[model samples]
Target: MVLGAVVLWELLAAFLERTMDESVYEYLDFVDATDSRIPRRSTRAPGLAKALSLLRGDGRALLFAGTVFLVGAAGSAGHNFLLWQLQDQGSSGLLMGLWVGLGPLAELALHPLRGQLLRALPGCGLELLSLAVLAAQLLSYSLLRAPWAALPVQALSGLSSGALRWRLQGTVGDVATPGSERALLALLGGLCAAGAGLGGLGGGFVLQRFGLALLLQASCAGLGLWILFVLIVRSRLPRRRKINYSRLLAAESSEMSDSEEENEDWLVKAMRDESFNRNWIQQHGIK
Candidate 1:
């Protein structure tokens, strides 16, 4: 059923893309033509070596990647232990399915509030909050005895997993150069897979030897330590201002279309003027 849903979603996206107005593509082309800063699409795809070189050269990107790897590891370990713990407590298959389903439902509930959350907490703040929520979930799982109790704990997955995924994408876009976005994202994906593989392997060994409780507790402790380390390092590092790409793109698009500019909503007009756009981008510390 899940696979079917995913397939349907992809088909829907492809349909929408195909049916979209050609003028929209033209406008995007105009924006790219006008904006010298916009990275041109490269003919050759970036390789793994290029992606690794990006991480090596960019300190902030490297730090973010490390955090992602640790989060993936801890998250994978906790998830495996959660199912095992539930089984040990004699949870029915139906209850286990419900527990797993609740996470995505929680994420759906939070989707409407994502913009507000992003506005309220910029930079790595949201990412840190997600990690903290994950830690709490881990701690709760460690102490869980009742199968039903796992449902509520799994709901935190929305904030921890969903929000982390969102912020990680934004962070990557912010740090990535024009042509490196795909490569960087691919690198992060590989890192996440590696982390998950190791986590499952080591977690299984620990679960067999030390039991589920110790596995959960130790994963929680390790994650907590990582959170603390990130906090310290973040405090010491200079903060980089993030660009609101959506707004910038909208403004640029509106400016490029003179006819549309006059009919644009008030919000678009706010940044419609060239001077205003420049000032806005500058204020956001974009070169």
Candidate 2:
């Protein structure tokens, strides 16, 4: 039923795309404008070598990539062991499914308050706190023998994994170069996949030999060490400047005449100019 629903959803999406007017997709204007401004000589997709060089040039991006890898590994290890731990505690398949579903439900519940949470906590600070929460969740999983007792710990996924994803995307956007944003994000995805694979392999090995308790305990300890390392390293690095996007957009909109606003060429030019200004500001390290 789930697979059929997914297939039907895809068909509906395809139909909508074919039937919808191009003008209705407003975000496409940004993509078109960006492409229009690119030099004919440099219109090719970003090469892997260029992307790697870009990553290497940005200190914050490098740090973020390393942090993402570690977090991914720890998160994957915990997830892979969760069912096994529950099964050992004599949890039925239905109960185990509920345990798995609760995390995403908690994440969904957090969506409404995400903006307020982001406003209340700085990005890096929120990320660190999320890591701490994740550590706690792992510790709970390690120690709790009662399947029901461990169910509450899954709710921590909202503040931990969910928040981490939000922070990671925002941080990537902040650090990435104008044209290199996609490449950097793709790199982030690659790191996540690699980390998860390694985590699953190593976790399974330990779980098979030493047991789930030992694996979860070790994951918790390693994550704790990573959190400390990130704290120290992040403190020594320069703080990321938050872009006032609302202000930038308002200023741009105010400067445009009504006739210019109506012109698609003018709109595209304005977006291109905004992109150029952002690139300049990032490159120059202007406060």
Q: Could you give the C-alpha RMSD of every candidate to the true structure, in order shown? A: 15.2, 15.7
On a 0 to 1 TM-score scale, where does candidate 2 land against the true structure?
0.71
TM-score of each: 0.69, 0.71
lDDT of 2 by residue, 190-243 (tens): 898898899999988998999888888898899889888887887798866779
Candidate 2 at residue 269, lDDT? 90
Every candidate's lDDT: 0.81, 0.80
Candidate 1 per-residue lDDT, tens place, 76-100, comes to 8776767877888999999999988
**Superposed Cα deviation of residue 106, candidate 1 (Å):** 1.0
